[model samples]
Target: MRSLEIHGIDDLRVVDRDDPAPGPGEVQIAVEWGGICGSDLAYWRRGVSGTAVMSHPFVLGHEVSGRVSALGAGVSGPGVGSPVTVHPARTTGPLPERLRGRENLHPDLTYLGSAAGDPHTDGAFAQTITVRADQVVPLPAGLDTRRAVLAEPLGVAMHAVTRAGDLTGAHVLVSGCGPVGLLVVLAARDAGAARISAVDLSSPARERALALGADEALESAADMSEEITVAFEASGAPASLDGILRHIARASVVVQVGNLPPTPISVTLGPIVSQELEYRGTYRFASEIEDATRLLARTPRAEQVITHVLDLEDAHAAFTTAATDPASSKVVLRLS
Candidate 1:
């Protein structure tokens, strides 16, 4: 089998390696589509994202859909050739004190393709990879592989919307037009939001936001609606956060969904205090994959979210294009 690994900062190598076999309660998947995420771009460009660094060779993909190739002992739900999506959460033991019911809160939690483990428990950027059977969620019937690849990112969007509570009848502002941000727009609309506004620096992203059902799309936060009652900041850019804080209505809820680089923002504490605004941070889905899948199944434009597909052998090019080209919405590397 062939495996692609990140040897160091900005170093990607495709090498022949032993095929992975499933352990008990695990299953081996023949990766069909692996979507490149924004975090993956951060890893490739800077060799680090958040607090994790690529200190050793690591596999760098997580948003993936595949068919069951083999099953490890004790796994029975999906048989060979079943379409599935990887949930991407690897836990150590029982959830920690601060992480109870919050599996993702454990500092030791390992996300597939993240620099959180030694040699990084291989990811979906290859032909064959094994993961716990429980981590495999069967794709909904009629869901295309490209759309199925959105399970993970959609999970994040779902988490963001969940953080804001009921969005029905509220004016929502999603402060990013990336895959995750666009998904937020879809999630809000599905939740019956009265209005959806998407903001991003990329024109293509803004256009996609509108096409995905946002009532308004802007290239920047300037002149945005002051009536936005709920905001999801998925851009991670400091300016975006500032804009979100500036435009949200009094008593509005703001969920910081994007991983911003370590930069300070000019947040007005007055409104947060005087208006009793609710501010929260949303992480990757802890145990929400099931619900995310159901929601995606209901979305009318689920398949249109994917913009490009590439062979797994073209991982480098795929990563490069995602980084340099704003037109590629969701770039997936197909292995089979």
Candidate 2:
């Protein structure tokens, strides 16, 4: 089997590895496509994402889709040859009674391709990999593998919209037109938002956001005159957070979906006090992977978000392109 591993800053390589076999309650997948996420780019460029630095060589991919090649002892349906996408997060053990339903909050959660854990867990960007059967979500009938690769990030967008609550007919603003930000535009529209506005420095991203159903797209949030009712900050930049607070309508809710820098930064609280604004933080999703698959099946335009695809052997070039190319939205690596 072949695996993509990150050795250090700006260092990536394809190396040979032993093929993994599925254990009880697991299944082995023949990986088809793996999408390059912003976090993945961060790790490749700087060997860290936010505060999670890589202490060892790490395999870097999580947004992946493939077909089941083999099933383990206890795993049944989603049989061999079934197409599926994976939910990357896995809990180390059973959650406490109080946190049973919210597995994302478990203290021992480990996510594929993440450097947050020591002796980093390997990811799915390989020829074949094994994962727990329960983490696999069957793709909707006729869903293309190119689009199905988006399920993970789209699920992040879905979870952000779910956090926004009752967007019915509301004017929504999405700050940052990156992949997740643009997907948030689609999710907000599907959630019944009356108007959607997107902000990003990249013209291509803003254009794609409009094409995906945003009513307005701007280079920066500072240009906004109307007060937005809800805002999703997907840029992870301090300026984005400040702009949202300054422009959003009184009593509006803001959801922080982007991974911000770990260092402390100053922010104004006048909006929170005088305007009674509500700010919330959202982590990885719980059950939205299924919703993402269904959403992609119906929204053909969502495919526009994917701008580049490369072979697994070209892993170094893939990460470089994703990190430096503003025109690129989602860069996927073809494994099969």
Q: Which candidate leads the pack in lDDT?
A: 2
Over the stretch 52-97, how does candidate 1's per-residue lDDT look in tens digits? 7778777778988888999998988699999889889887766667
Model 2 TM-score relative to the real fold: 0.97
State every prediction's TM-score relative to the real structure: 0.94, 0.97
Q: State the TM-score for model 1.
A: 0.94
lDDT score for candidate 2 against the true structure: 0.90
Q: How many backbone clashes does candidate 2 have?
A: 0
Off by over 4 Å in 1: 96-99, 263-270
Backbone clashes, each candidate: 0, 0
Q: Give the 10-residue window scoring lowest on summed lDDT in candidate 2.
A: 219-228
Model 2 residue 180 lDDT?
96
